[model samples]
Target: MENTHGYIPSALLAGGIAGTSVDVALFPLDTVKTRLQSAQGFWKAGGFHGIYSGLGSAALGSAPTAALFFLTYESVKHFAGSETHWSPVVHMCAASSGEVGACLIRVPVEVVKQRAQANRYMSSLQVLKNTVAAEGFSGLYRGYISTVIREIPFSFIQFPVWEYLKKTWSEYQKSEVEPWQSSVCGAIAGCTAAGITTPLDVAKTRIMLAEKDSLLSRGSIRYALTVVHKEKGVRGFFSGILPRMMWISIGGAIFLGVYDKVKKTVSKYYLKKHDHIT
Candidate 1:
């Protein structure tokens, strides 16, 4: 059996690499999604131009945020005996906890990233400086609550589905899943989650990209959603659904695939080294 101690380091490194890889690789898609969801409309929000505008902040934040999330998620699973039972509830809880922890870093990053993506700022640093100067330090965390609200539900759906799919495949095949299989499972789960939770995502994007001092910028999820509904109707809630689903689907595949591959490799190496010492 693998030692529990090995999981921590594996989770950290694998999560970091996976996060950075997916974010940097799919940043253009994410930028398009952000712009599509922007209140200013697509063309006004830079409309496919500067698709890589926020790549720096996304790259910088992805590693740490993903690392923190997986660290929390794996720790919770290990402690909760998820390896033995692998309950969906446990997966949901672990994913939720991971989202909560990850969002601390993620929200600030998203604020800069989405703003840059919308062409409001030329660079991550510029966005950061202007936001702080205008809205104070709290500006960096503009959509913290809304983001958590969006992410938790997304995790509630995605992680449980991913775990269940992997488990089912493993049972059917009578072997552990390949990283590519995990990627497929992750893509399915992410796409499903993205489609269902699009309204919440739009709400988060609206809150983050809202003008300073605007009602939307006040960060009330309900009010922001209400305003969106009032302005654009139900369709507004799904503004970026296509790009969102596409980005997340591809992103999930790369993210989870890389994570599984790196974590397994690192864990196996660590176990072998440990056995040698013994």
Candidate 2:
């Protein structure tokens, strides 16, 4: 993490790579989770249970959304990265801020992707056209608020734990930690955060996947809870929890491993070039 520190552009590139790679690789899992969480469950969602459904939209949005997140996060962290006393707070704030930028791009893509996963639309183009025609441009951002709610805490929980763990590992190892170390830290944090946040995630997905003007379309946390509770009891809120946990846990490894690798490669090249210049 330190090697990757002090560089904003590097973070953008690494974040983009990490975000794109994980989302693309785990997209099938995401599709399955979304389908399972739908009010209709897996059977009612139609199709031949194609796991990779709607991957295009997800991958498209993932790059920029994730890039923006790291760009903002790294930029903020750079200012306070070295401040041990302020490390956790800095990581928390930076991660929270990062999600704001991420959500702008992510929410729309998620809207399209989730709908496609539900078999509401066959193509990304169709999802976009129909969404705009149905709810105008705003329709693309249908679950914007809920996404922030779900994502911000995820970043908050993940980054602090990641930062602390990285610091501890570096101290214990008496050397710069390797990418694999970062991957393990990231996996643990991702699993913990995703597990804790499943309820909010469930709500976010339900609201985003809801049809226009439908009862389920309400984006309020309260609405999501009511629907889940009234319909399937406590279990409804945890419907797709298993698939999601697996996706996130593994996705965390891929994301952090790639992010650290890319960060090292990029930063080393530039630093070496700068040394040659000097």
Q: What is candidate 2's lDDT per residue for 58-139, written digit by digit as tens?
A: 8888889888988888888887674678788898999999998889999999999988888843887788888999899999
For residue 109, what is the lDDT in candidate 1? Answer: 94
| The 10-residue segment with the lowest total lDDT in model 2 | 1-10
User: Candidate 1: which pairs clash?
Assistant: none
Each prediction's total of clashing residue pairs, residues at least 3 apart in sequence or on different chains, is 0, 0
* lDDT value, candidate 1, whole model: 0.92
| Highest-TM-score candidate | 1
State in Å the error of residue 82, model 1.
0.6
Error of 2 at 56 (Å): 0.7
Top candidate, metric lDDT = 1
Model 2: per-residue Cα lDDT at residue 18: 97
lDDT of each: 0.92, 0.85
After superposing candidate 1 on the true structure, give the runs of residues whose Cα lies further than 4 Å from its correct spot.
Answer: 1-5, 84-86
